[model samples]
Target: MNIFDIPAQAWAGQILIGLINGSFYAILSLGLAVIFGLLNIVNFAHGAFYMMGAMATWMLGNYLGLGYWASMLLAPLLVGLVGIVLERLFISRIYHLDHTYSMLLTYGMTLMIESLFRNAYGTSGLPYSAPVALQGGTNLGVLFMPNYRLWVVGAAVAVCLATWLLIEKTRLGAYLRAATENASMARALGINVPRMLTLTYGCGVGLAALAGVFAVPVYGANPAMGSDLLIVVFAVVAIGGMGSILGSIVTGLVLGLMEGLTKVVYPEASTTVVFVAMIIVLLVKPTGLFGESR
Candidate 1:
């Protein structure tokens, strides 16, 4: 390989990293978009919920000896049950209020949860190692790739697609959409609007939990992990415009790749690159690439 010529292996590795980041962005933003589309809540606590999911998995694996696969299945269910309780107890109280009210409520909830975790677990990051089954690296002639990274990308894509299909192609999805558009009409037509909303929230939170569970072994279950990533996800959603399911997915991966390219070209701007892109998008198209006026 020439000194100036691009190293194909390094390039492929960067793209793979970008794909993993994009997978996280896509799944997290999709969950946020889904809940917001129907409930009209900003879910400020989404990051906290994501962290809780990760923590739940770590704790389960620590105390109960649940493996990665079991944690993958159980973490979401537990976190989603918490979401249902939060929605029913606190979020439901402000359904008739302005969007700001729910936003503030969730924000407060986020702070409280963060504080609780700090008080209990402290601010230090905890390490969660990948399972033995996923511990090796694979050589694909061009580049050597970590198996866990491959698994993360695959799982995230599968979950995102499954959720999208559930919400777009099924009768339950039709009812959810109907309720989102007109709750009263949906109820009159025999749809259980409240139940639908509750389940929708649960599913949204469950998606976050899934993301968290997958992330723990890779990044470690930190108290502030979700808070940090949530900002990036928010930027992704802003640039993508949360208008359609597919748009969120595409924008996430595209932005992730863009970020990777930035790293290759301009290292200093990598951190703020997403926000900078968000600003450009807003200036050019306030409604975002896929968003519509409410």
Candidate 2:
């Protein structure tokens, strides 16, 4: 069939794929927003952490016989602990420096990590099969949707919501927000701002690692996979707003769907669609769809 003459089933499938992509974008960008908003540092190593998480899951399965479900929890925790150490040792040292320093430090770290993995694993992607329970597909009338993809969407939504409520409604979230708004004031009020910042950074990287774990079954663990998606995620964050939590979630999903739609109508532009949206959003809103104007 001609591209223009694609069937409804094809459209449904593409939309489902788009939603799945969007789910990942939302989760990744949510972590970015939390880190940038609270810590005032752009984490360039985020994508690296994601790669580590996927690698960790693969390692855990191959060596330790851990399943996908177990990897989901264990991988993040292990990666998060590493993040905590990095924060304490390196990231904490650069808190007083310019944002460029943090970005450069993280970027260098990303390159180092990617090189290490490339040397060990080679360029070929590793295999990671989905759990047997999620290995089937569900017929949705017009489309046959994969069970794993549906689970991904549901899990992403649940994670984003839980994160939002934690940041917007919970007591600890209040402290985080307070520190974000005015670290000195928060500290004066007895909040341990530095400790909170360290934890926040760790949490953000942990979230990225969690995304990687979720992605392993679909994309397989690869050294450069995270870098490939990082650019698009940066666009998503920009289009949604830098520090706006809701903006990141909404923008990520919307852009993912839009990218999918572009694939249907204009296949050549599919890859650039999110960046185009980013430019348009910058021109119109400047602060992003959900970002507050400073």
Off by over 4 Å in 1: 1-4
lDDT of 2 by residue, 1-294 (tens): 377698777688778889999999999999999998888788888899999999999999999999999999999899989989989989888877898998999899899989999999998899999999898999899977889989999999899989999999999999998976898899899999888988898899889999999999999999999899898888888888888889999998898888888788888999998988899889999988888875
Residue 287 C-alpha lDDT in model 1: 78
- Tens digits of lDDT, candidate 1, 171-268: 99999999889998999999988899899999999989899998998898888888899989988888888546676777888888877766666668
Candidate 2 contains a number of clashing pairs equal to: 0
Best candidate according to TM-score: 2
Global lDDT of model 2? 0.90
Global lDDT scores for all candidate models: 0.87, 0.90
CA RMSD of all predictions = 1.9, 1.6
